[model samples]
Target: MREGWEYKKLGEVCCPKNKIQRAARCFDSSDKILYIDISSIDNTMQKVTDITSVTFGDAPSRAQQKIEYGDIVVSTVRPNLKNIAIIDRYEPNIVASSGFCVLRNTECIERNYLFHYVTSDIFTQHLMKITTGANYPAVRDQDVRDSIIPLPPKSTQLAIVSELDNIKE
Candidate 1:
């Protein structure tokens, strides 16, 4: 770790306090919700491009994770493919598949910084090593939360994010 930087478990920096895992049936059947499945996101683009609008009753059992804007959603299945995206938009009815582990930033870390870190080779390699299953290698949400990250100062995080954004453009 660099000077002034500290190692922090991802769980320490982010995750909802209550750790609420709402069920899909919690919503009314007639209500329309924006559903994001693993396929709805373009991991390479780091963007969600194909959200579906479905009644709550029509939602798949996997469509149970509520998401807010800025949350990082990483696929728990087939992690080698690195399916992940940062939620840039939020609607009252937005929800994601349970196959994802939604990571919401807290005061200790910057959202973009965490997003970039999880999408990095270091993180992916670590995930690949710990993941189980041969045909469908996967990691539990706890595996993601337990991953350690080098947390730099907020200013440095912002600078890194800016440079990364520029590279993407």
Candidate 2:
């Protein structure tokens, strides 16, 4: 660990998850959204490779998580597959499947830094430990919230994210 770095639970550095309607409460036929599902993420590339356009009338039951730009979405199901990505360019109609645990950064932490932390092998292994079900191993959203994150100062975080993003490119 760095001399000035600290550790915080992910939930501590992230905004509280807003409570949204869990089910198909109501939707007009004309209402539509760009939905990112587990399949939408190319885990190998750590990017959203496919976004399905769906109208509210035919929206998947799991398309309930509204994400904003800079938010991180980690797949709760099949944590080993590492389906995670940051919402780099969100629009009003962007929503992700509830299978993803959406993470919105608090002021203290940089969003890109948080994204990099979760993409680590350590993070995936931690989730694997809490994963349940033999046929469908998965972690709950709460499990993801409880994970630990290493926090450097904002400047250090930016440097780390920048280096990693350059490598990614």
Candidate 3:
């Protein structure tokens, strides 16, 4: 909706990368990294609970995205903005499902910016238009990778994130 912001698909700005859970192994109950599944992620921002575990043997081939503090992890299946979350210090090493679309941030776009942008009415409307499914209403990984967004100045993006943070506080 703002100037300089161009319409793009989720894939162009993001890689939609994924890691496969290994086979011929079982993860025990006490594993360290939190295993995130569709059920583990709520459609709305909520306390992350119901986490499972992935053993060293079962750990994903490689972490699809290094989910650092402030990064946003979006669920690809239902493809709802409310399900997005800003990674925090409290969030330890974790791996999400293949059904999850991990957005790698860029110099032109900050993580917080992507979070808000994806959740915005403008982007959501576009997302709704692109997504297809009668029951699942899914958006493909390729579609996500090609998605475009308004390219704002870095300082402006930081300021916006700050304002949003204040509101949350």
The top-ranked prediction according to lDDT is 1
What ranking of all candidate models by lDDT puts the best one first? 1, 2, 3
Q: Which candidate would rank higher by TM-score, 1 or 3?
A: 1
Error of 2 at 125 (Å): 1.0
RMSD after CA superposition, every candidate: 1.5, 2.2, 4.8
Residue range with the least summed lDDT across 10 consecutive positions in model 1: 17-26
* TM-score order of candidates, top first: 1, 2, 3
- Residues 1-169 of candidate 2: C-alpha lDDT, one tens digit per residue: 8899999989888988764333344446577878899999999989998988889668887888767788889999999999999887757677789899989888999888888899999999999999999999999898999998989999999999999999978
Q: lDDT of all predictions, in order shown?
A: 0.87, 0.86, 0.62
**Candidate 1, clashing residue pairs?**
none
Misplaced by over 4 Å in model 1 are: 20-26
Worst 10 residues of 2 by lDDT: 19-28
Model 2 pairs whose backbones collide: none
Question: What would the TM-scores of all predictions be?
Answer: 0.93, 0.90, 0.69
Writing each residue's lDDT as its tens digit, candidate 1 over 70-135 gives 888999898878889998885877889989888999988999999999999999999999999998
